[model samples]
Target: MSSQRRSYESGHKPKCLVVVDDTAEWDRAVYYASRWAVRVGGGVVMLRVIEIPDQNQQWLGVADVMRAEAIDIAEQALDRASGRANGVAGITPERVIREGDTIAQIRKAIEADVDITTLVLAASDGPDGPGPIVTAMVRHLGSFPVPVVVVASSLTDDDIDALT
Candidate 1:
């Protein structure tokens, strides 16, 4: 086990599960998770789920192509997330890429793999903003095993200046 994982096992600190989607919104969750991890001497798991299209006998080739694309996208997203987290101090995070239903996969990772003491999620901007994805995540949160933290996006510079 890694030193970070060992720390979690020893109950020396908390473990955070961060669900990473291919969107700028995830930055909010990552930032919050990193901040909390440092404050509590905890570790983070950045999980990216690449949904595989349903396989059909006649569409094996198409499915293969889609799977490859999904893998590529997930890898890129994970790499960027890792880099961003690394740039921050005292926020070492582990990266994981898996296939299946995003919510189900994330839940399973938290339950069976990650020793998650908290679940940090980026809040969806709503129906006029991001649609079904936000709904699905909200629905799943009700049954999540660990405590869930939702981080809303920060205001833009223009918006902040306007308030003043």
Candidate 2:
């Protein structure tokens, strides 16, 4: 929590933060966020975080290469997500790429931007259950910086439109 939100006050507008982690159900979240932005006259923020693995001394030189690769992938993911959001609501979303724990990065993004009032995520339909982030989010839902909206993987565009 970072001070009182200034959303809908003059220059500031409410925003929905959507994670674009290249997950199988990422589109669901983006769609929901885009629709929400259009309906409520809010904005959208898309975030992609890179979770880099630790490397040994022998792999010192490879760290740079790995980081470069991760950044490139992050850019591509954000591009696709941005395209989808634009197609849905004709709104260009603010894209952010951070390197670290997903949940921590999300918190940083929200703290960095006061207008972001909601987090939208899509559940994975795997037999194991919803994806890790969504599962983890369930446990911390009560203390998360903002309200979260979880979209089911099975939802169609029409289903989302009707709900939003």
Each prediction's number of clashing residue pairs: 0, 0
> Which candidate number would show the highest lDDT if scored against the true structure?
2
Off by over 4 Å in 1: 1-13, 124-133, 155-164
* Model 2 score (lDDT): 0.92
Model 1 residue 88 CA deviation in Å: 2.0
Q: lDDT of all predictions, in order shown?
A: 0.71, 0.92
Which residue window of length 10 is worst by lDDT in model 2?
Answer: 1-10
Candidates' TM-scores?
0.79, 0.94
lDDT of 1 by residue, 7-69 (tens): 366545567888889666787677777766776777789999888868888999999999899
For model 2, residues 56-128, the per-residue Cα lDDT tens digits are: 9899779879999999999999999999999999999999999898998989998899899999999988898
Error of 1 at 5 (Å): 13
User: What's the residue-level lDDT of 13 in candidate 2?
Assistant: 95
